[model samples]
Target: MTRVVIVGGGPGGYEAALVAAQLGAEVCVVDRDGLGGSAVLTDCVPSKTLVATAEVINQVRESGELGVRIGRSAPDSGDVSDVSTDIAKVNARVKALAHNQSEDVGRALQREGVRVVRGSGRMAGPDRVAVTLADGGTEELAADVVLLATGARPRILPDAEPDGERILTWDQVYELDELPERLVVVGSGVTGAEFAGAYNALGSDVVLVSSRDRVLPTEDADAATVIEDVFTRRGMTVLSRSRAERVERRGDGVVVTLTDGRVVEGTHCLLAVGSIPNTADLGLETAGVATDERGFIEVDKVSRTTARGVYAAGDCTGVLMLASVAAMQGRIAMAHALGDAVSPLDLEEVAATVFTAPEIATVGWSQHDLDSGRVQAVGIKLPLTRNPRAKMQGIHDGFIKLMCRPGTGIVVGGVVVAPHASELIHPVSVAVSCRLTVDQLAHAFTVYPSLSGSIAEAARRLHVRGQQAPRKDS
Candidate 1:
């Protein structure tokens, strides 16, 4: 039987171990962070759970608009002020949920008969792995195939190190027992935006510092515009073109100095700069695996490295840094390595979501692709304010966008911005993956007074525009 050794217990490594074991391979997983890695134990799961609590607080604050009194008093009693979030309770719940998820993943892997080694793993040779056991011992294992999914950690700036008290990383924030009076989020990317939005909704004064002109610079421009407007309207201060140079403790609070010589004082600062792959000291050179300048593992579409019988996936490979993408890459690696039918990873069709007050989800091509003249397509955007369900829910800031081929009307990509947009983007993902046309999407039945109805409406509008265009005789 083939022997598979997976290094790291993140979504990629654990998922690959299951597939390899089910395929009749002897599988062993070396993990240091219990099970489920940072995605479950610290980063993704913990952050989302906190956001869920914040979402509840937001809903309760809007109870008056729904004609539903929130507290134990009449609507005119101004009971909204009574609605507040307990940071201690929220943090405790986040940790509990993350721990439960990690345990669940461990149970699943164990049921599949995959050996779990509690330690850090490194390449001893091309086909050998040396596990530095958690108990301070070492174990050498033989492998026919080795999968590297060591994942990544938060990128820290030299001048602005996290004290874990006043300054924090995404993973360190869960330990806070109290909410900050003024929270400064120093990054305008998805992580920064999510935390800023969540805190603002949970009754904290938030200031978002963005080096770029707008928040979510990498996302759809229109979606970013809507989110920025919402942030401003909800009392969150957005400082554009401001880059954090350093952070230091100032008497009772923290002070963040910008590159432009301006200082912003806050109760706490959260750094969301980016991440660095966990590839150093792993003996990659001895194993003959190649890496990029930034130390990210260099792998092909099938997650194969330069060395034979070696594969890499997840954030370590610098593919997309998304859990879903990591899982798919892991599965693809296992199937290809074990001589099963498989297809190469197609990044264009990958679906992604940003968890904020009004979540942003997208699949396939983007408006940037169209603007750059990389692809020929026609698109339309429909506001969520026009949707009956959104109006009922008091959600007015968001839209549904659809992009299709100008001639054939094949749905190539789409974006959704609204509450629960993550769940609404699945149908669009299917259309993009299966190469469905605008007519096909429009013909599908969506329930009335639903946010999903806007998806169909956008597609129908695109279909009509396609029909009206002049055609050339061949």
Candidate 2:
């Protein structure tokens, strides 16, 4: 039996352990954090759970618009009772849900006959792993193959470090007992935008500082514009082209200084600059496993490292800092290492979602590719405001976009921006992965008066547009 040792208990490490065990390999997982790693314990699960609570608050605020009387109004003053969120209760629930998920992942791995070691793991050699137990003891394990999935942590600026109080990282925000009256989110990326949107919906005055020209600079341009408009309409201050130079505690409040010498003050500041992979101090040099200059472990399509029998995946590999992608990379590495049929990682086919209000989800080629003439494709974008379900739900700030080959009409990619966009993107993901054409997507039946109807509509439009395009000569 092949002896496999996986370092880290994140999605990548844990998923690989299960697959390796199922393939009859003797598997052991060394994890510093509890099972499920940051995804379940702190980052993804916790943040999304908080977003869910915020969504409820937002919906309740829209009750009057829906013709539902929430609280009694005074005849003379015309004042109705206000609805407020209990930050303590919401944080408690987020922690509880995260804990439960971590426990579930642990139990599942145990049932699969994979040993879960509570400790930090380092590569002692190409085929050896040294585990530093939580109790400070050390144990060496022999391995035919070693998988590194150490994951990552929030990246902090040199001049502005998180104090876990006024200044905090995304992982540290769950500990707050009270919501900030004024929250400053310094980063316009997915994490920053998601938190800013969620908090603003939950009744906090938020200021988003973006070094770029707009929020979600990496996402679809139209989607970002909608979200930014929503943010501005909801009284959130968006400071574009502003880079935070430093953050410090200022008399019970937080003050952020921009590179241009402007200062913004808030009750609390959340640093969402990004993340740094946890790849250092893992004996990578001793094992001949190469990493990039930023300390991200370098891995090939099959997750193989520079070392012959070593593999790496997940955030540590910097392939894509997403849980689903990490899990898939882990499975791929295990299959290839254990002599099973495996496919190389195809990043274009992967689906991802931003868990913000009017969530943004995308798969495959983007508009940038088309505009750059990198790929010949026909595309169509249909607004959600045109969808009957969106109208009923009072949603008017999103769209569904489809891209396909001009002649063959093979669906190359898609983008969905609306409530529950994450769920709506799955069919598009399937179409892209299976190389389905726009005609096939358009032919599929979608529920009427549904947000998903827009997806099919976009596909149908793309199909028509594809037919109009001139074919290439053989």
Candidate 3:
């Protein structure tokens, strides 16, 4: 059997192990952390679960606007202001759900006959992995193929280290016993915007510190603007063009100093600056593997590092830095290394979602690509207010955007900005991946009074020279 050794039991590692084992490879996975890695145990799963709880509260807060009384005695007796979540209980549940998910991944790997080594794995030599066990023991394994999926950790500045209490990292916030009276979030990236919005919805006075002209600088400008507008309308204080220079605990609260010499005080501070890849001391040099100046492993389209028989995936590869992308990269790496028919990774098909109150989802080429003349296409944006379902849901802040080829009208990309936009973006992704024309997409039946209908509507508007595809019923 082909021997495969994978380091780090994140989605990339575990998922690849299953594929390798099923392919008749003897697979062994070495992971120091739990099976599901940070994506499950600390980062993605935990954060989204917290957001789910906040969504319940957010819905109740908006119930009054829909003529639904939330008070106990009188219609005004039980207001949404009375709806409060116990931080401790919510955090406990988050941890429990993350732990259960990790356990499930572990069980799945075991059932696939993949050997999981509980330790930190390092490259001992070419095609070899050395693992340091928890009990001070060491184990070594020879491999026909080696995969590295060691993920990343929250990045902190030298002057702003997380104390795990007053000053916290994204991963450390779950330990809070109570909600902060005021939360000052530094960094306006996806991670920052997500936490900042979540805390704001959870009843904390939130101040979002962004070093850019607006929040979510890398996202579509319109989507970012909508989120920022919502944040401000909901009473969040956004300090644009503000950079956090230092974070320090002051009494029971925390203080953040900006590079421009302004200070912001808050009951707690969250640092979502970014992440540092967990690639240190992995013995990359021993295996002839190489990393870039930023310490991210450089891999080709098939996840191959410089070393033969060696591959890398997940956050370590620095390709998109998304869990789903990491998993896809891992699968591709295994397929190529094992002589299975393999296709190189294509990022254009990947869909991303920002799980905020009014979520934003996107697939294929982005608005930035078209606006900057990177791609020749025509685009259309339809406001969600025009959608009957969105109107019924009282969701006024969102839109459906579609981009198609200028001549043929093939769907090139799309964006959905609304509640559950992630689900709505899937069809757009399919259209882009399959190279379907706008008419083909518009011909697809979408239930009336649904947000998905807007996707079809947006496509119909971009029909090539206004010609519609013949429908089966028509």
Per-residue lDDT of 222 in model 2: 80
The 10 consecutive residues of candidate 1 with the worst lDDT sum are 465-474
Cα miss at 419, model 1 (Å)?
Answer: 0.2
Comparing 1 with 2 on lDDT, the higher-scoring candidate is 1
Error of 2 at 342 (Å): 0.6
Clash list (residue pairs), candidate 3? 71-78, 72-78
| lDDT for each residue of candidate 3 in 38-89, tens digit (9 for 90 to 100) | 9999999999999998888888877665767654524653234556778899
lDDT of each: 0.91, 0.90, 0.90
* 1-474 per-residue lDDT for model 2 (tens digits): 899999999999999999999999999999898999999998999999999988777666654545555556333332223678899999999999999999999898989999989898888999899988998899999999999999999999998889999899999999999989999999999999999999998788999999999999999888899899988977899999999999999889999999999999999999999999998899999999998989999999999999999999899999899999899999999999999999999999999999888899999999889889999887878888788988887776888888998878999988888888999999999999999988899899999878888888777777655287533111
Where does candidate 3 stray beyond 4 Å? 72-79, 466-474
Candidates arranged by lDDT, highest first: 1, 3, 2
Which 10-residue window of candidate 2 scores lowest in summed lDDT?
72-81
Off by over 4 Å in 1: 72-79, 464-474
The prediction achieving the highest lDDT against the true structure is: 1
